[model samples]
Target: MLEEKGIKPAVVAGLSLGEYSAFVKANVLSFKEAVQLVKKRGQYMTDAVPLGKGAMSAIMGLDRQTIKDACEEASILGVVSPANYNMPGQIAIAGIKEAVEKAGEILLEKGAKRVVPLQVSGPFHTQLLEPASIQLKEAITAISVHEPTLPVVSNTIAEVFKDKEQIKDMMVKQVMSPVYWEDSVRTMIDLGVDTFIEVGPGKTLSSFIKKIDKTVTILNVENEKTLEKTMKKLAELEA
Candidate 1:
């Protein structure tokens, strides 16, 4: 689906498993390696916490500070913390079920537009996932990772991996750090990337990019038809 579109991402970024895909695209690892790493990551994360003990929620229409305050205000029963800072008004918070629920209530009371609970096994990007992060760190150093052909922005800092050592460290930290998604998109724009092609299972990334900059040419390629269309558009741009 990706190759057909000629939408080779100049700077590939991913959200969770999407990071594995980005690594594969960047030739840092083979397809088999990517799959193996993700599988191991999933297993480690799952084993770190008991099943049904953790959860995530998307609190929209609220800024980061507001959401942070809400999480801090509602930090009861379990660890509620902001996971992914998707955009100015969109953030995903993760922690124990009760803490997440309390945070959601506080946000809603404070005029948050909506709080949607995510279907996830563990509280990703939180201290609750530190055990998984530690285990994953060992696995990352053990694996063979090479520099990407182009800049690969990390979710944790929204910065491109410029140093091999940083790349190695960021991989582990990303497992338990808030994804600086908004900053990443902004940085890409600042670097003159007017076009964004999200190659994945859904159009979520593209949607977020649009929210970041409506004028940017953003497209999602999930099937043959979209792939063909994207290729045609890319060709036109080249012409």
Candidate 2:
């Protein structure tokens, strides 16, 4: 719709599974393929971890190294690592429930401002999701992927995907690797993306992008109202 007004994304990206949407926008995956692949991806992840065994938590106001050290210390209990680096002072950790809780405690003791546990199905974006990665690789390989019409940033490596061939491996590694959202957003800024539009249901990405770089224009389209507002903002930017 924005294209009709001579506006389009300079580069595309999303958080976690949201990456699929970025791929769709970049023409790496057709809308239909994205839907089917996402469904199977969900199924595989559910099958990978039993409910209550895995967990995630948001550790706020802590440095990356502090959080990493806490997770490493807590790994004695089970798998635990930094799952998502959401913003400057906020990072999410995931792994076995025991380890996550333990890491949270350690982070707090280490002077973290807050360690808030998240209500999630299973420990995503960690080694716990390895099974899901393997399954997703096969599913993605079955599809007809094309090189991106525009750059699509990857969450795992915090870099733009190269071509059709990189998608499967990137997707496979993504499931078990931490999402460098903060880094990805920085990469976009370096790419000269002065504006961002979060085209989904929530403004979480908008919030993170704002934290990463306040100067960039951020917009969202979740409903009719937001779409109208976003278009108005884009029009003004264009003007």
C-alpha displacement of 76 in model 2, angstroms?
A: 0.7
- Scanning candidate 1 in windows of ten residues, the lowest lDDT window is 1-10
Clashes of each: 0, 0
lDDT on C-alpha atoms for all candidate structures: 0.84, 0.91
Which pairs clash inside model 1? none
lDDT tens readout by residue for model 1, 49-135: 799988899998988888999899888677999999887788999998899999999999999999999988889888888899999
* Stretches of model 1 off by over 4 angstroms after superposition: 1-7
Candidate 2 wrong stretches, greater than 4 Å:
4-6
In terms of lDDT, model 1 sits at 0.84
Model 1, position 144: C-alpha lDDT score: 85
Pairs in clash, predicted candidate 2: none
